[model samples]
Target: MISMFVTDLDGTLLKNNRYITKEDKEALQLLNKKGVDITIATGRSDREVQAVFKELNITGHRISQNGTFTFSKYNENVFSQVFEEGTSLKLFDFLHAFDFPCLISNFDNIHYAKEIPMAQTLQSLFKTPLIYQQDLRNRIEQDFSTSKFMLLGETSELLSLEKKIISLFDTDVSTFLSADMCLDIVPKGADKRRALEALLNQTGIKKQATASIGDGFNDINMLAYTPHSYVMSSAEPKVKLHGKKTVQHVYEAVDDLFCHNLIL
Candidate 1:
């Protein structure tokens, strides 16, 4: 009884870092017609996720900001988590000491601490526009809703920073490393699973009745919580280990769901 079909967008559903396959689009349409609710869960912001939704013609629930926020079909913000102003300022100052570029997201926009090569590369890759700020620390006092912070650099540098971040923030933040170079730091209390739980509470969907497919460290909690979980074959070994099953493509997961009634 798969009441909800939640999937991560980037490495899982979007092939080649750009688009979803025609076959997957059609399969999701059919699954929705069959009474299965489809949800897009990702580390993307609301605006970033909207681009994918527009491409897929999706107007369902969304778990965005890596679980910092959730939105209903009407584009209503049903759940959200934000950094306290003091914490935001503290983190901003701490991260600013690094020469590496940092990217911060308000609920509506993304700001870059500086115009470094890594930030420019990520801006091009994610295709999300950003406002470069030389004094990002000061901007944190402007009362904007700050949700997530990210740093992209060499893997070794990111790993070292990850350790430092954990030691400094302790349990105050959640960290995810992906693509070998990007580290995402969000509030510890929020995640894809937490947002999904909120959605389930509102919709009365049982955890076991949910199906999820993803291929990132941030997707681990959501994948582990659902009974029917699929990881992409291309995922990193660490990510693949957390999934109950693995599929080569999104269409394969859909085929298993609709063709074979594989909800278990």
Candidate 2:
């Protein structure tokens, strides 16, 4: 009954440097030909997702910004979640207190408080420019449409930050680890699960009829949202449990869904 497939980008579909492998491209084309819906769910933004689509020469729905934003196949806006009043300030208090390197992300742009080498390195990797705003707090206050706040650090440090974020905000905020090293924070109702639920509603696709594949901790909720979840072989052992099964690569997951008729 699977009619839709959602896959994460980094470390799952893209082999390296935002490049899609031949196997993945072929698998996606097969799915397209089979009249199955294919979408990408990632922590990246609209620009990054668009670039990925162009590189792969395929188009479908997109769940962007760790589920803060969703777009239709033809590049139409579906929905966007933004921080509530005073929420950004509260998060800024913690970011300022911890002296953590943070980024203020909107749908199409990333703004930084100041110039940081690590942020610059990420820019190089993303091939996207970072907007410098020395007074980011003021900027957030002026425009409350900020999608998510992200903190970058080592894996252990990010885990510690995750604990701090959860303890500080409790259920008032939603937080998860992305890329295995960064902490992505959003409001309580903004996450992959919520976004996917909304997408299913839009497409009239049942949860049981959808298959999801991902590798990062942020992807776990989306993986668990469906019965036919597949985690990549490169994922951590802890992440594997979220999915019904594991595949050596994204193409294998697709093949299982289409060729083998296997749900697990």
lDDT per residue (tens digit) for residues 1-264 in model 1? 788899898888777666889998887777777778888898878887788777777667888889999987667777899998888888888897897778898888888876777555566667478888877777788876689998878878988988998898976888887444678888888899999999888788899888999998888888999888999998889888888889988778878776656543
Q: After TM-score superposition, what is the CA distance of residue 121 in candidate 1 from its true location, in Å?
A: 3.7
| Model 2 per-residue lDDT tens digits across residues 222-255 | 9988988999888888899899989978888887
> Cα deviation of 100 in candidate 2 (Å)?
2.8
In the order shown, what is each candidate's alpha-carbon RMSD? 1.9, 2.2
Q: Report the number of the highest-TM-score candidate.
A: 1
Model 2 ranges with Cα > 4 A deviation: 262-264
**Count of backbone clashes for each model?**
0, 0
Clashing pairs in 2: none
- Alpha carbon lDDT at 49, candidate 1: 78
Segments in model 1 whose C-alpha atoms lie over 4 Å from true places: 118-120, 262-264
